[model samples]
Target chain A: MIAFGILAIVALIGGIGVIVARQPVHSALFLIVNIVALAIFYIILSAEFLAAAQVIVYAGAIMVLFLFVVTLLTAGKDDEEAGEELSGQRITAGVLAILAGGGLAVVGVLYPSQRIQLGLPQNFGNLRGMGDVLWGPDFVYLAAVALMLLTAAVGIMVLNRPPRKKADPEARLKERES
Target chain B: MMLLQVVLLVIKIVLLIAILMGGFAYTMLLERRLLGFFQLRLGPNRVGPGGFLQPIADGLKMVLKEDLMPDGADRFVYRLAPVIALFTALSVDAVIPFGAAIHIFGLTVYLDIANPSIGLLIAFAFSSLGVYGLVLGGWASQNKYSLLGGIRASAQIISYELAMGLAVMGVIMTTGTANLYKIVLYQQHHGWLWLPQIGAFIIYFITGIAETNRTPFDLPEAESELVAGYHTEYSGMRFASYYIAEYINMITVSGIAVTLFFGGWLGPWLPPIIWFFIKVAIFLFVFIWIRATLPRFRYDRLMNFGWKFLLPAALIYFLGTAVFVSGVL
Candidate 1:
């Protein structure tokens, strides 16, 4: 319980830091900390597979992508002077952030009244159980997810394709002049 | 009884760390000597008998050397990077089984630190976390070369990780478990999964090399191009931390390879621990040999190879294994 409490607090602070941090890279680092805290929470809940997946997928692969993009674009130059031009916009964001935090706290307080047990079965978080869920009755859902990911990949490829020579006005004009 | 168990656990942890540190030291010496012979030269033989105490000398030098940090570098993250690297590298060993549990003096002792049910996934997760160290170090250094190196490392790791994970799926499918101990036992009964999962094994080994950023995939640290890459600005013990992390990661990869494909600790006549070390040593030797033999790959070519060839091949092998294991083949 103490571990859970500590993790929860750290995750909460990390979540706040993600939005509050001026530098994009720092924000991404905060997100990583938040993700790691969540993974620990998964472990404490006996969802060992989920915890590992959380680290591998979210904290490892996805966050690497996030940090790469952040570093490539900004390179840690997003200081306070360059951030948020309008005061009204900042005020609105602050109000929304507070609302979201309060809403989450209210949900947490009310969740236990629903009598939903968080305790999982002995095998529920094991690889066997995860495989059964993925490949058994929910096979169609898994297939759908795979199909969606494939479509997204194809979309990226199409978006990234080199422009046709004929489609380039400068090239067409040069060809005509030649 | 509980106190005895705790004591045993403490002992195991200490022994594992000591052995791993010693292993890392000797592995460095072996690599230097082997690389020297491969290139027709004698390597570092003056420290101790046949350079046996070379790592100790190297460690002392690193400690005595001045710690140099680039001006305008992010000091906190710069310092944290090597710690993150070494931590992830060492912690992944928790899931790897060196051998089966043995009974000693009316007590049971497992060979590894912790054998979680999702041991395979945990190992992958921890290994994957090592990328953060490279990326953060590069970014923190405030150098263009370091930043580029970090970016390259992250991209390479992310690309190859998919192939690596898919390759492991084949073994997991065959064994029907993700636990390393269970997988090893299954391999013993089934005469090693490598025969049936040859394609997966090959892909796994290649991806393992790429994951650890060895030669051919060492574009991140391509000395000719990036001037020692992301670690160019680091010095002294901080530099040594990254060096130690890389070697430890090499060992961890070899251990995983042995456990998954080579049948962990399961040879005849010899003890299981000895067999395990022999297997890991062979893999480590192969790692060094590949580094000596192969030239570094171009960044674009490396990315293309990983995504185009390795990923698809691993996917095909994974699906094939799944189908065969399900008795539909």
Candidate 2:
């Protein structure tokens, strides 16, 4: 429980740091912290598989790419430039955030207590359990997600495909003359 | 009882770190000596018998050297990078069982630190995280070479990691487990996996070399091109940390290879722990041998080899393994 509290505090600080950090690279690092903390939270809940996946996919793979792009694009850039190009945007965002928070609070109070479960099955998040869930009755949902990812991958390949070279007109004319 | 368990855990961690660090030192000496032999040279034979004390000398020299931080560097991350590198490198060993459990003083002690159900995945996760150190170190150095090195390291690691993961999936499928100890036990009953999964083992070894940023794929720190790569701006102990991390990462990769494909710690007559070390040493020798034999890959060719050749081969091998394991063909 104490560990959980500490992790919660760390995650909160990381969330704040992502927004407060001036540099893009620093923001990415903070996001890693946040993701890692959540991964540990999954471990605390006995979801070792999820925890590992969380770290591997989120903190390890995705964040490395995030940092890569940020460094490439924003390296050595200063963050002090501020133009009031979108005046009152911050105020509107803050107002919407407050309203959303209030709405969530109201929902929390009004929602039936029965919706929340107090106990979990043993090894409920282990590989065996996860495999059963993913490959058994919920296999259709898993297939759908896999297909979506495949589509995205094919799209990337298409976008990166090089333009086909056109035959040279002068070469053709020279060959015809010969 | 809880106190006793905690004490045991702490003892295990200390011992593990001590052994791994010591292994790192000697692995460096071993590489130097082997490389020298391969290149027809004497190789550091002055200190102690056959240069056995060379690693100690190297450690002292590293500690005594002046630590330098490049001007205009990011102070915080520059300091943080090596720590991240070494930490992740060492943490991967926690789940690798060194041998069968031993009975001592009315208590049973497991040879490994932690044997979580997702031990294999944990190793993958920590290794993936290892890239942060190189990338951050390069980016923080305020050197174009370092930044480029970091970028190359990330791209190379990410590309090869997919092939490595797919290759290991063959072993996991055959054994039906991710726990290292259990995998070894399965091997004891079913024989070593290398013969059955030879194709995957070959692919795994190749990708493992790339993942560790070793020769033929050591483009990240290709000194000829990048001026020592990501740690170009690092000096003294910080540089030593990166060095130590790389060697230890080599050991971790070899250790995993042993556990997965070579029937870890299973040998006739010899003790299990000794068997584990012997297998690991063999893998380490191959690593150095490859380093001495192959020239570093050109950048574009390295990426092409990883993405085009290794990835497809791993996928095909994995599919075959799955079919066999499931008895579908």
Candidate 3:
């Protein structure tokens, strides 16, 4: 009821926030907010696990990676290296975002979520159900993804580890405890 | 109908502002006291007993202080930066359930402003929005130190937020809900969510500190390097916005932690609000304690930790929880 109004407001604000942020990095961050808000809308619709997964996958995994890569490349200096000129890339992103957002709005107006979802158990699609599906039917696939995640995690660890340096007192204490 | 909604929204905004500003005022005093405790010394007993009114004095001073902007600053964005930072900080509460639903007259009123179905995501979204303040604040200041610091913040938060999100995902896996109240309810029937998901707790806690620009993980505002970092150029209420935002954010983080892990408003003896506040305070103490004890992380190390350590751990935890859930449920 009232919840829909609030989500609409949040989505609108977050959408504007994406545009309002002066930097691409900032804009990217705002998009995280928009996405998360959308995920929360999913939660309100009783798609509980989907909402969490949305934050987990999109906000946690994708956006952070996006921010990290952006920062790593740009943190070396200000973004002026790409030239102060508002290049074609900016125009393209703007048009694409506008078209997508406008198109979505039209869709919403055309069809305002009429099909009622039945038997949406409170915890459906949560880690529990997700696990049921994963182990029952999707175990092999999940295992492969697990292997991939492991490889990626290991790869990142190997890539990002600091050069061996003098251990801190805390590290020494920890080692001693272990 | 629209008018009523507008009025309600305005009231919520006002209440939010009051809570934040009030919390910010007391948080200064609380932090100093906490810092002093960690250092084993009495702190700030000068103005009032135990510096009870120190924040008031501090606010008065900040308000009266020079509102200076460094030269060559981006006039528009520089000024706009604080507002954005402050707004995003305050906006997260639109969905967070402060306490259980309460009845006033005939209306069943929940303390949270928005409480949108996707409440958790709204909070995360606002958190992501927060990085802009740091970036714009730094870029607008025109100081090289500020620029570098701001750039670091841009990089660091964006990087760490990923790990943070994953950590939260682990929680999502367990509770299977995104609405704060539901998350809390999920926590209530089960054991404290943190016990089973220790890895998620650690990752989430560490990255949360980074997200909120707190100590140890606080490379963006590294005092030794950037001379207040992104906030070098801000003063008065503008500066207050950043500090205030940080404290309010501290409350938000603590509140979220309580909801997600500590069983929000479920403890007996006291009312739900009291339990929520107490839990939040405990975490807030942990924040201050960590600040007092730990050394700041080098910038590169912060990124490495996020990517290498926290993210992977969160993923593993999520998978384990999911499997466990599959077996049990």
Candidate achieving the largest DockQ? 1
Superior by TM-score: candidate 1 or candidate 2: 2
Clashing pairs in 2: none
The regions of model 1 sitting more than 4 angstroms off are A76-80, A83-87, A97-113, A165-178
Provide the TM-score, chain A, model 3. Answer: 0.51
Tens digit per residue, CA lDDT, model 3, A1-178: 7988888888888899887765666677578768877987977766656776676567655765575555444443343434646659878998999999999999999989977876666457654566678778989999999999999999998999998865698887887799
**Tens digit of per-residue lDDT, candidate 2, span A24-114:** 8889999999999999998999999989999999988999999888877765646586577988998999999999999999998998466
Q: What is the lDDT of residue A38 in candidate 3?
A: 92
Please count the clashing residue pairs in each candidate, in the order shown: 0, 0, 5
For each candidate, what's the DockQ? 0.72, 0.69, 0.12
Give me the TM-scores for chain A across all models, comma-separated.
0.80, 0.86, 0.51
User: How well docked is model 1, in DockQ terms?
Assistant: 0.72
Per-prediction fnat: 0.78, 0.64, 0.09
User: lDDT by residue for model 2 over B59-159, one digit each (tens)?
Assistant: 89999999999887888999999999999999999999999888999899999999998799999999899999999999999898899999999999999
Displacement of residue B90 (Cα, Å) in model 1 is: 0.2
Q: Which portions of model 2 show Cα errors greater than 4 Å?
A: A77-87, A109-115, A167-178
Docking class of 1: medium
The residue-by-residue lDDT of candidate 1 on B138-159, one tens digit each, is: 9999899999999999999999
What is the two-chain DockQ of model 2?
0.69
True contacts kept of 2: 0.64
* Full candidate order by lDDT, most accurate first: 2, 1, 3
